[model samples]
Target: MLDIFKAIILGIIEGITEFLPISSTGHLYLADYFIKLNQPKSFINMFMVVIQLGAILSVILIYFNKLNPFAPSKSHQEKEATWQLWLKVIIAVLPSVIIGLPLNDWLDKNMTTWQVIAATLIIYGILFIILENYYKKRTPSLTKLNKLSYRIAFFIGCFQVLSLIPGTSRSGATIMGAMLLGTSRFVSTEFSFFLAIPTMLGASVLKLGKYFMIGNAFVGNQLAVLLVGMIVSFLVAYISIKFLLRYVRSHDFKAFGWYRIILGILVIIIGSIFA
Candidate 1:
């Protein structure tokens, strides 16, 4: 029961931080330190990634109104709009699939190492600071998905692939990438949120496959924990998404960038002492 309670806290952290450029993995690291999750069971090791599926599902549920994209559009233009949005998302996801699959092995071997995590966190955090200073393209919100250029879509996908390095953050990389390419911050952010559903769900499915192949006998209980975690993540993510969209409308991401730099330094320091 105590273990279950700890799992709940982890799930909440996952949901709240996963979609933000704030780095869910970093927060998980901190949460683990606080809860002493360093000495983890096999399932517990994968538990963080597994819990992210819950946050992914929250994207689907909360954005169901748009993400559903199932019904026939009332007009020809609407049909084109739907297809265009999907095409962009597909373009954005493809490069990651190509790059990430090959890198997965390398990442897994080095993932738990402080050296790897520290380098990725510090390097990417610095990039965040420089990238945040660029101009914010004020693309009108009315500019629907169909209006997005193919080059922009392709580049966004390419940008997202950089996040294969753990701690680089998919949201941070993609959103900053889009902004550099002249995408308005709001549009880039919304597109990143839209793109996250398929990207994250596919990754989760892949992880689930590996979990079963590893042949854990306690699979049933782990699945139960996963379901509980997913529900918690979904609830929290729905709220976070709403909060961030509104917050970004009025403010810049300077605060988040500063936050990443501070936290990255903290992670390196604390890990040196305790890791």
Candidate 2:
């Protein structure tokens, strides 16, 4: 029962932070530190990765029509556009797969520390503030999704490689990269949403595969905890995604930037005290 409650809390954290420029992994690490689930380190690690599937599903649920290539009501042009969008999403995720897979274990072993997370949070937070200011005076060149080129998509994937560092957010890296390349905030944000579907799904599968390969499958109670976490995360992420899309239409991300900076400093302080 206690574990179930913890799962719910973690789920809420995952849902809220997953799409935000703030790193979900960073927040989860902090949560797990304080909550200190009694599960093995291995199980805990698997749980964190697997639970993100819930948030990924929220994107799929909300953007089904936009992302779907086979909608019955679609014109040929709309279907073609959807396929092209998927291709761009695919291109954007390739760099992460190429880089992240080989380094996953190393990052987990070395970079998952509080000190590292805090440092990344501060660094990227500052980057966001600076970028937002730079963007304010400039008009975006690529206002429409179709205006986004394959070259830009691949370059954005290159930026996503930076997110291999624990606190460097995947959406933050990609969205910032897109904007710097002349894509508007709305286009970039929506592209980030589409990009997450494959990236996170692949990650969840890999984590689950690793868990099973090591002969550590979830048993009955653990399974229940996992399900509860995923379900709650899905519900919360649905709301979070909707809120972000609505929020970005009229506002910039400066607030998230400041929030990241404050959170990072607090993490550093807390980590020092705890250490």
Candidate 3:
């Protein structure tokens, strides 16, 4: 029962942080550091990656019609546009594949510390504030997904490489990069959502594959814990996705930037006292 409760807590954390400009993995790491689940290290690692599948499913369900190229209700033009959008997503994910695959193990081993997370959270937080201020003086040039060129998409992917670090939120990096490349908040946010579909799915697959290959098998109750976490995360992530889409329409991400900064500092202070 306690393990189940822990799963619920972790699920809520994952769901809330996964899509926001906040780092989900960073939050999860902190949760583990403080709450120390009574699960094996291997199971814990797999749980973190695999539960992301639930978050990914939420995106698919929410964006079903828009992302579906073969939706029977769509006209030829709309269908073509959907396909083009997917092509752009593919181009944007290439850089991460090229870079993340090689460094995945090393990053997992060396960079999952609170210090690293705190530094990234604060640094990116400041970047967000500075960029938002700069953009206020100049109107965004690219306001729509169709207007997002392939080259720009690729560059956004390159920025995603920055998110290989633990605390650098994938959505945050890509959205900021898109904005830097002259895209509007709505477009940048939406593209980040699209980019997450492939990026996270690939990550989940790789983690699952590695887990199984390493002779790790689900022990008693572990499977149940995994399912519970995924389901809860899916439900919460669905709500989060809706809220973020609505939020971005009327607001910039300065609030999240400030949040990242404050949270990072608190983590550092807490770590120091606890240590």
Candidate 4:
């Protein structure tokens, strides 16, 4: 079915950018310019959030190799360390719940427009450039997640709430916030990954709940589309995460900024030409 193809394409987009700080929603909004889908706004919007579970699963899958990943060593001193990491993630996620979800109606009504997306893409692109320059000065290589402070994590979460705007990247905002708060590129990148699991899972669950309540629940065809999207997203996200980590080790996020800039310009140009 054509619906299945659309789901697959959107799923690929979700997987590729969900963790990259490139704004998956922004990309999806742009993707709408080309790949047409007849999905109702209720489903289309919710599907964007739901498919993210696929990308978040990739984080857990790839990082399961860590020895004490979310846990500190077994020592008493380190015992609380792992729990503390979880606490930090939870604290960081709190702001989005308070700020993002409560504002869902307002945002859905106003911010889900190409104009808002283009504006955010440009504004956030400048912030990314500024933050990248800031990182050049405060280069701390505290690779351990335990080194991340609660306050810094909360601030990162605050920045994440900004990503509720379509073109604003949750990973980008959090990483840039962490970078400003003294986290190294690698540490911030990893933190973004860890934070994404909880955030994306919460989002997907919420969407699923709403869809179920509305009784627009996936039937045979919709179920097929959902499954296809999940499988494709898992595959693409795995590769994207691997490639992004390797890419970040060698280069700055400037390349992504340029890409955002180009995309933003295209949005404006396309809107003008067609309008």
TM-score of each: 0.89, 0.97, 0.97, 0.90
Please count the clashing residue pairs in each candidate, in the order shown: 0, 0, 0, 0
Q: What is the per-residue lDDT of model 4 for residues 1-275, given as tens digits with 9 covering 90 to 100? A: 99888998989998888888778877887788788567677766666765787788788889764424344436765556666777898999999999878887688788877788888888778778877777676657566677888888999888888888878888888888777777777788888888887887887787778777978765557667777888888889999989888887777787787777777887788666653
Considering lDDT, where higher is better, how would the candidates rank from best to worst? 3, 2, 4, 1
Best by lDDT: 3
The models' CA-based lDDT, in order, is 0.76, 0.88, 0.91, 0.79
Question: How many clashes (backbone atoms < 3 Å, residues ≥3 apart in a chain or on different chains) does model 4 have?
Answer: 0
- Decreasing TM-score order of the candidates: 3, 2, 4, 1
Candidate 2 residue-wise lDDT, 158-203, digit = tens: 9988888999888898888998999999999999889889988988
Per-residue C-alpha lDDT of model 3 across residues 1-275, encoded as one tens digit per residue: 77888988999999999999989977886787676668998898888886788988999999999999999999999999999999999999999999999999999899988899999999999999999999889999998899899999999999999999989999999999999999999999999999999999998899899889989998889999999999999999999999999999999889999999998997788767774
For residues 6-93, what per-residue lDDT tens digits would candidate 1 score against the true structure? 7788889888888888778777776767774432366776677678887887777776656545555336665567777888898888
RMSD per candidate (Å) reads 2.6, 1.1, 1.0, 2.5
Task: Give candidate 2 regions above 4 Å deviation.
Answer: none
Clashing pairs in 3: none
The predicted structure with the larger TM-score, 1 or 2, is 2
